[model samples]
Target: MLKIRLKRAGQKKKPFYKIVLMKSLSKREGKHIIEFGYYNPLKKFAYINKLLVYKYLNHGCYPTNTVRHLLYRLTQNKINVK
Candidate 1:
């Protein structure tokens, strides 16, 4: 099954993440099918491709809870994610 989730990136103390499309059983950091966005906790930053997200969602790809929450936060923050 395909899934939309976050992939860890960035530095030690300053954490970053990439929102990716991948297989459900794959390793957390395993190969991803698409990298559509990024998040930076320390900077309170997030940028995502909403169109791609919806595309995958329609194709039966589920987003992890954290990623789901991130989408909510994106909307709340009014960051023009689309």
Candidate 2:
């Protein structure tokens, strides 16, 4: 099954994350089908591309728990921006 989740990146002690689409059995950060967006925890920042995100979501892609929360947050922003 294809899943949507975060892959850890950046330097040690300064974590970043890429929201990705990948096969369920793949290793973390090994390979991904798509690199959708990014998150920086220390800065409390996120940049999610809603177009691609909803495209995957519409196609039955399953998101991780954290990614689900992030998407929930993004929905509000998209609405407010419109």
What TM-score fits each model? 0.86, 0.88
Tens digits of per-residue lDDT for model 2, 1-82: 8888999999999999999999989998779999999999999899988899888877888888788888888776422110
* C-alpha RMSD by candidate, in order: 4.6, 4.8
- Number of colliding residue pairs in model 2: 0
Error of 2 at 49 (Å): 0.6
lDDT to native, each model: 0.84, 0.85
**Candidate 2 clashing pairs, residues 3+ apart or interchain:** none
Query: What is the clash tally of candidate 1?
Result: 0
lDDT of 1 by residue, 1-82 (tens): 8888888887788789999999999988899999989998888889999988878787778888888889888766422222
Candidate 1 structure, TM-score to reference: 0.86
lDDT of 2: 0.85
